[model samples]
Target chain A: MLDKKLLEVLTSPPDAAVAIVTQGKDGPHVVNSWNSYAQITEDDKILFPAGRMNETEQNIQADNRVKITISNREVQGKSIKGTGFLVIGTAEFAAEGADYDTIKAKFPWARAALAIKVESAEQTL
Target chain B: MLDKKLLEVLTSPPDAAVAIVTQGKDGPHVVNSWNSYAQITEDDKILFPAGRMNETEQNIQADNRVKITISNREVQGKSIKGTGFLVIGTAEFAAEGADYDTIKAKFPWARAALAIKVESAEQTL
Candidate 1:
């Protein structure tokens, strides 16, 4: 069963810190701290800026299964943790159309964006 | 497989942001942002402070399964996410013995601590 609080945090809008990891030749290379959000779809996918060509994306291409972890801070000793399965199926240039335009409007520094479909999700304590 | 970088970050010592979510009576109440660490165990379980008697712990008592998300920040557009399954089985007073002593030495403000054992773990992008 998933922790309800964690799910709410992961599914919350605006800004959430995401960690994207892909398999590298040497090992698994990880990029720490990127802004992300969940894409509304039948399968409940997540969308985030992949940015320009980077090692993380290349590793994802090599292996589609990627892990995404998210967290939010709290004042007391409580916090929420959300982990989900991600696979990169499509890539879109930020200069393309409405989707890209919306992303660019929010994050002007993003060059490209990656569309990820979440396969599984779990909450952690 | 877990991302090497993310695993390193989650398993790394010092300071890591953790989110702990448990079931609540009125929907799902969440306490965001707590400091945590991975407990060294034969089963690869991660242990964190439950902190006295709180709503989060109460929810866990009703349902042992809990979710824990850990994350670390980076300068670039990348971050590492670690999510895992947790079950609360034991509670220990910080003044008990070595285990509590160590935790208390590090976290002075903590009252009583709940011990959690992780069952499953995965990485997120």
Candidate 2:
């Protein structure tokens, strides 16, 4: 299940880059987004605008598994001032769906929507 | 060579999470670190204090390839206000070496040092 702390992290003011990790032919490829850019759907799927995630899209086509890390310095951790989470999930890119429309409405540059169905979110901080 | 812009991002301020991605048997695993915690060595290698990166250490043993993303909102982007970088590199953990000692001296909580030798750093945003 997705942790509530993750929702807090996303809503909080941007403090750190959100990292999206996907497997490539040679190795793991990484892309970045900000906390302000993430939108959580009613079913708990996370939506991120895809402006130029060409390599990320290609990787997901070959393998749908994705890993993401999000953090916020303003949020309280288990025992510290900052908090973060490691999200293990599966993802797909949608160019013409409700998800794409939702993201496109928020981010004008979005050509597609990177939708992540989270399997588990572990609070790392 | 590592892009000088990455250095600027690291030194700017704590505005976004730094993500460290390593490949696991199941899939790619992601971890989080802050920008203020990274230390660049004289040789241009980046070192991070490892408090409990056991999974990250294990993944690197199987495959040394690592992907890192660091971002800073304060840094000027190519055509935007924010700037970020995708770092494709090789990494290893040091428990007792010059690298370990360097990180340990700065971060008392660190039991090991996660050192990354940069292969390339591309400015993404």
Candidate 3:
């Protein structure tokens, strides 16, 4: 189960880095962004807005496999330390629907919604 | 080319979080750490000490595809901001030799060295 601590870390301010690894033609390709948005789902899935993700979108479509990590200790002058996590999951895309609408609403530039079905999550020190 | 600004960021104090995403069996696996250690090679590869990374080591050996991100702003009460990067690369393991010895000398607990060969990199906001 996704605990409150994990939720807090995931929902932290935009300063936190979001790293997503995808299989590339040459090797493993990494796409990272200073994340300001991520919606946690009922099934523990994480939904991210896929905006301007030309290569990332293609990589995800080609291979749903992905490893995601969110970690940070700085934001708005407060040090909310001691919480980070690594999530392993399968990614699926949603072009239209309530989920897609919500994501687009949050990030106007969103081209689609990347929904990750959580397989496991581990705490990081 | 790797710039000085990026080097400063990558070599920043341990408050910054290092997130590494690797391909796993179920889908993708994420392994993260506070990362007080990393060696930047002449060819732009990033080396990290792999200690107690049972699953992560396994995953890397299986696929070698990965994405990595490092971001932070608060450490020792100083904020050095405006620098973050995403690196897409291939991962390889080295059990021993000069490269491995160098990593071991830096991190005593490190069992093996995980070297990531840089393929591409992009600045993150």
> Which is the leading candidate under DockQ?
2
User: Which ranges in model 2 have alpha carbons more than 4 Å from their true place?
Assistant: none
Candidate 1 vs candidate 2, DockQ winner: 2
RMSD of every candidate to native, in Å, equals 11.7, 1.6, 5.4
Q: Write the per-residue lDDT of candidate 1 for residues A2-44, one digit (tens) a residue.
A: 3445455555432344545445564334444434443333344
Alpha-carbon error at A95 in model 3, in Å?
Answer: 3.8
Q: Which tens-of-lDDT digit does each residue in A9-103 have in candidate 2?
A: 98877546789989888778889888889989888999999989999999999999988888998899999888988888999999998899899
Q: Return the TM-score for candidate 1, rounded to 2 decimals.
A: 0.44
Q: Tell me, by TM-score, which candidate is best.
A: 2
Which 10 residues in a row give candidate 1 chain B its minimum summed lDDT? B84-93
lDDT of 3 at A80: 39
User: For each model, chain A TM-score?
Assistant: 0.63, 0.96, 0.83
Judged by whole-model lDDT over C-alpha atoms, candidate 2 comes out at: 0.88
Candidate achieving the largest lDDT: 2
Stretches of candidate 3 off by over 4 Å are: A24-27, A41-44, A73-83, B21-29, B41-45, B55-67, B72-83, B88-91, B95-98, B117-119
- What's model 3's overall lDDT? 0.70
DockQ for candidate 3, C-alpha atoms:
0.37
Interface DockQ per candidate: 0.06, 0.70, 0.37
Estimated TM-score per prediction?
0.44, 0.94, 0.71
